[model samples]
Target: MLQSYETLRQTGIATVRAQIRSGGYASHTAGLGRNLLQANLAIIPQEFALDFMRFCQRNPKPCPLIGASDTGNPILFTLGQDIDIRTDVPAYNIYRNGQLVQSVTEIGDLWTDDLVAFALGCSFTFEHALIEAGFELWHIANNVTVPMYRSSLETVPAGPFRGPTVVSMRMIPEERVEEAVAISARFPLAHGSPVHVGDPAAIGISDLSAPDWGDSVPQPAGHTPVFWACGVTPQAVIQQAALPLLITHKPGHMLITDVPDTAEIPIITNKNMPR
Candidate 1:
């Protein structure tokens, strides 16, 4: 059986990495690593690195770059002392010419000298904040992956990378909307605040029951579906570019970083939040 989120909090980061490294644990990381920062992963060939980096720059909220690897380096030393880009994340999604081709626990076999990995801040960061502040997340309370959708909004193009913005939704009580926004805003590393609140249809999402990625959370009475820019935006956009290979963390399987959720970094990975 998979470890419960509460049980995972007791498991240290090193042990968590060990479990994943050995192929013993391959579950979503929503509630694991309680006080630690979590990151979304994106790996691509060196030829596409600069443009991908620029793509992230043009779209900061959905693709908040937290840490990136030097081309050809498998380890991401900045996020954690022992992070191995090839094996740390629980699962990886391999995209071939814009389509998901496979999901694997580890990518060591496919490691190449020309690949660069990028780590982006995740919504998991603010989840810690919400829980700490006593706000319940629709997905976590019910134990499901956060619901994500393809929005009608278009991202600023960077080279061949461009697509509609993707968003993750959480149904918040009509009352706690401000609190949800305030808590999340503290962690700019995470995709900070809601891009759209109240109505999913306004953002071009027609069905709350159906989503592009992850399972849909229950939308109870007295709640509004709140949407935030998601890390998946870059992967979706890059996938549209039809790259030979693009690697990203399977939606909820994030890299648990050693850093605390509130640690203010001098530089946010490659660039600052767009002004």
Candidate 2:
């Protein structure tokens, strides 16, 4: 059976997708894709697509839209030639009426032709940039998932989608904070720079040792927990909407896309985005 991220590290995107499709690797995808851009998956019906897209528009920091699919289509032509929303991800979370129903490795049976998949920009590339610049990510080094928290920061609501902005924390040393910001700023789709720095209490995060999602990471001696607007924010917001059906990538198990981190994607902002 296929195993760890390391085992699939050398494989290409197609191979990795195939591995996940086989249900042989349902694991956290923190450091696997190298320089490849990763995306958070949100599959909803066409009936909710317009509102959801507007939600992503009003709240770009957490719900940065990168790629999207048409109604009744599983293929995100921009992300990959053969990307399928139903089985490309390592794991999926099913929600009904704003409550989690179950987690599945694949959504083949739950998929409907009316579903539209949205691929939002994720921070894997930003984390990669940090590592390339000599900043160490504790979760990546320790082989655990990054710590994520549901912050007190409210998102700009669009229709039924409204929730606190979720953030992922990385412990950065005192001196490297500026350097981290500069590197991350280049990737606007990666949620821009650090949303919050130092003192988790300011953001209403009560505990550094306890995260709302993913594994808890220790706060090293001189390092401070720097929070970034996570792509998981949309999933959190969608859950509260209590839609009849909502499907999302299991937290930390993102969909690895073929797009390179350095690729110059179109500057898409503002609510006037073309459908």
TM-score for candidate 2, please give it.
Answer: 0.93
Q: Where is the poorest 10-residue window by lDDT in model 2?
A: 266-275
Question: How would you encode candidate 1's per-residue C-alpha lDDT over 1-275 as one tens digit per residue?
Answer: 35555576678887787877777788888888877889988899999899889989888889888888888888777777677878889899999888999999999988899999998888998998898888888677666789889998889998899989999998888999998998888888888988888877888999999999999777799988888999889888888899999999999899998778887651344322222
lDDT of 2 by residue, 24-114 (tens): 8888777777787889989987899999999999988898898988888776767766677788888999998889989999888887889
Go through the candidates in order and give each one's C-alpha lDDT.
Answer: 0.85, 0.85
Tell me the lDDT of model 2 at 180: 89
- Pull out the clashing pairs in model 1: none
What is candidate 1's TM-score against the reference? Answer: 0.93
Clashes of 2: 2
